[model samples]
Target chain A: MTDASLNTASTQTGEAGFGDYFALLKPRVMTLVVFTALVGLLAAPVSVHPVVGFAAILFIAVGGGASGALNMWWDADIDAVMKRTARRPIPSGKVTGDEAFAIGMTLSAFAVVFLALATNWVAAGLLAFTIFFYVVIYSMWLKRWTPQNIVIGGAAGAFPPMIGWAAATGTVSIESVLMFALIFMWTPPHFWALALFMRSDYDEAGVPMLTVTHGRRATRVHILVYTILLAALAIGTGFTAVGGPIYLAVAVVLNVMFLIGAVRIWRRDEVMSEADNYAVEKKVFRLSLYYLFAHFGAIALEAGLAPFGFGGW
Target chain B: MSFRQEHELHKRRFGRNLGLGVILAGLVALVFGLTVVKVSNDDFSVETQASGGQN
Candidate 1:
């Protein structure tokens, strides 16, 4: 591990600022965590009080941010090497590793304890497990070990909705589990598409991403296979209690578009993808961002309509 | 500024920020403790019985 003082010494001017601290939180990732968790909370069979709902989401976001900070602290070295991550607070010398570690630990404790207080221990336990999984299991262990890192490490990201569902109902159910599976299945395709375009970053960093280890051909095959499985799971979710016409429609459209993109990616050779600067891969990655939000948004819509006769079949 | 002065300034700033963070964390913990007490005292049956009686 790089010493914090060494990092600080390397930057002769300007100490860490507020923005640097916020960057440590990875607000972009936290946004997905908050939105998906909110959907989980809202879609549960029981309704949560507005205050409790707000508090639960807030703490969950904090926990997500804590994981991000801890990840940055641990991956500062690799992050410094990866082009996509070179400008992060720690690597850019705007924040010290010690500061990030302290902040991450403090916020992790705060978020878990407050969430348990606001809702139930089940949700808190899940949140704690998520932080542990991301920081220890994923960042520290799997990231350096194997090409299947994202495949298995995706579980950390998949837990938020389940946590939210547990917060609302104090227990897990098929609906929450299905929500988790949606993200879990989506992770490989989403990230592999990114790895397709940004293959060199993983290569230079020696991170052993699938694109680096198994080659893009195998990664492409994995993406298509996962997309097929994801499409089935996503479409099937529409018939459950949480599903409605709105969710089903969104799922069908998104999955069709997603499958087409995956097929395009799978068919393309390096020459073709490079000819367009991996435009097709980039499009698939961008579409995936909307893909997840739309599915969750549709689920939220279904939950909103459940009070009337219009929601589920 | 001299090197010594700059070092002292950084030290002061770090101390201030750490103190503020600790204070904020303490406040959140206090609120969380209070919320746990309030939630535990809440009566779910009151709402259930009220709705049932009204019906």
Candidate 2:
């Protein structure tokens, strides 16, 4: 082989490995799936055996990973240009696109079928839709075509717990739908806040994000609007069988703090936003991560106490 | 539209695509076999504590 050919082979071999394959799964997002699916399993009115529940969460996590892998595969080109995602499995050549695509497509089918076998058809169907939504709807279609990508695409991540709920109950309920809505509503604000700080990333990559398409000021305003809606939905979660005074208190405090941050961002100048300073934007971004976790954490708390009649029924 | 690196964009020949289909089908079958084995041996009716929030 010529020197250039040998080098290409070396780069491909070096890039594709077990770790890279695993990275394609996006473990951080998978963690959210596990937690939310667990909560859904716990929150359901019906009960599942411990072993079955464990299996359910496992398959759901696999499904989430499958979605991530497919997303990485499809977005590899865009990801290579974006600094934040430049090191991803496909982008780095650590995983061959065909391998990543194969893994993703394979896992999607596996997870959906197993979820159905282990639990019910409803849960399996939800998993199937979630995968399709993320890959076909969010990644392929919505991403390049519009700025509303994150708003609608976020629903893919929101379905796990509902899938878990259906696994246990074999049906959908207001509770499950609300859980889905909580994430769906929370996603735009959560992602838009990050988009504000990383506006340049979207611009250079030409992903047509809200900030890139509408500018930072518009993105901030949208973030605040979505944050308002998200905060309201979060606090509202406290009123159902999932809520109590403790959960209510947590929501009020978190939402208030979140609102203050959104307002602060709204007031900041583009110069200030683009600066290296992390005080305001950093807080908002970090809070966005914890915000969803805290909400779910409170839900878990309510469920744990509900059986004892400690928290509200 | 663009390949991240040389290998990621290797055009899948018919043989490669067929191989992928077989591998994916095998994985589904394997997982299904394990699931059926477990279900037959273990009681699925056993219930435990429900998990999260008001619902």
Candidate 3:
């Protein structure tokens, strides 16, 4: 490398600062976690005390931030290698890897302990496990070793709503499981779509993405399969206790459109991929964003209707 | 006071506002109040007071 020295910038050049450390938490992703977790708390059958609910969500957000920090800590090497990720907090010398690790561990402990104190032990335990799953299992293990990293690692992001539910209700339920299932199903297609267009990213980063490990053709098919399954699961959730006619109807229409998009991707030619560049892949990525917001919005709507006693399966 | 005291006061003015707690609480209350008001106007005459159920 001539592009930029891959050495830790924090020590050599001293780029690490307050903002850089904050950025390591991936606040954009944390915003999504907070919003979804709030929806889960609102939709839950149980009502947590206001302070308790606030504390639970706050701790959950911190846990999410902790995961992001640990992810940066571990992926520093790859971040230095990849163009898109070259300027990340750790790789750009904006933050030291050791500092990131320390921050992640501290936040992780604080989140789990405070969540347990504010909510219930069960929710706290789940939050702890979620952090471990993301930092230890996904960042440390699956991400470098296998192409299915996103598939399994996606579990970390999926647990927020379930934890929010448990925080409210003190236990797991079919509805929470379904919420988990919806996010779990969406992860594969969402990330694979990015991988398809950004294949060179994985090549340069040396990340074993499905597109890199198995070829773009295989990754495209897998995205289609997972999208279909996600659609099915999304629609099925509407029939559950947490769902209602509104959610069901919305799920059906959204899933149908999602499936159509997946099929379009699958049928396209790879030779054509180089020509169209990011069109198809970008479409898939944009659709995946809509897919998540729509599902959660429908859930929130169903809950809104419930106060009227006019919505349910 | 030493230089650190003056600097701390100046920084607090510019650093991330710590008053978000009340702001967030106010927002939540506004939304909850709006929901109650909307429901009251609607036909939800089930006398649903405060929540006390499980899913």
TM-score of 2: 0.83
> Across residues A1-313, which tens digit of lDDT does each residue of candidate 1 receive?
3333344345433466556788899999999999999999999998787778888998999999999999999998878777788788888777888999999999999999989988899999999999999999999999999999999999999999999999999999999999999999999999999999987788878898999888889999999999999999999999998898899999999999999999999999899999999999999999999999999999999998888867777
Query: Per-residue CA lDDT of candidate 3, range A1-313, in tens?
Result: 4333544433343534456767888998898788778778878988666766787888899899998999999998888777777778877775678989999998899888878866789899999999999989999999999999999999999999999998888898888888888888899999998888877778877789998889888988998999888887888788888888888888888888888888888998678877888688788799888878888888888887887887775
Ranking by lDDT, best first?
1, 2, 3
DockQ (C-alpha based) per candidate is 0.14, 0.05, 0.05
- Of 1 and 3, the candidate ahead on lDDT is 1
Each candidate: what lDDT?
0.90, 0.82, 0.81
Model 2 steric clash pairs: A15-A94, A16-A94, A42-B50, A42-B51, A42-B52, A43-B51, A43-B52, A241-B54, A242-B53, A242-B54
DockQ of 1: 0.14
Q: TM-score: which is higher, 1 or 3?
A: 1
Mind giving the per-residue lDDT tens digits that candidate 2 earns over B18-47?
A: 655775796577566656656665343232
Error of 3 at A282 (Å): 0.4
Q: What is the lDDT of residue A132 in candidate 3?
A: 92
* DockQ of structure 3: 0.05
What C-alpha lDDT, on a 0 to 100 scale, does residue A208 get in candidate 1?
A: 88
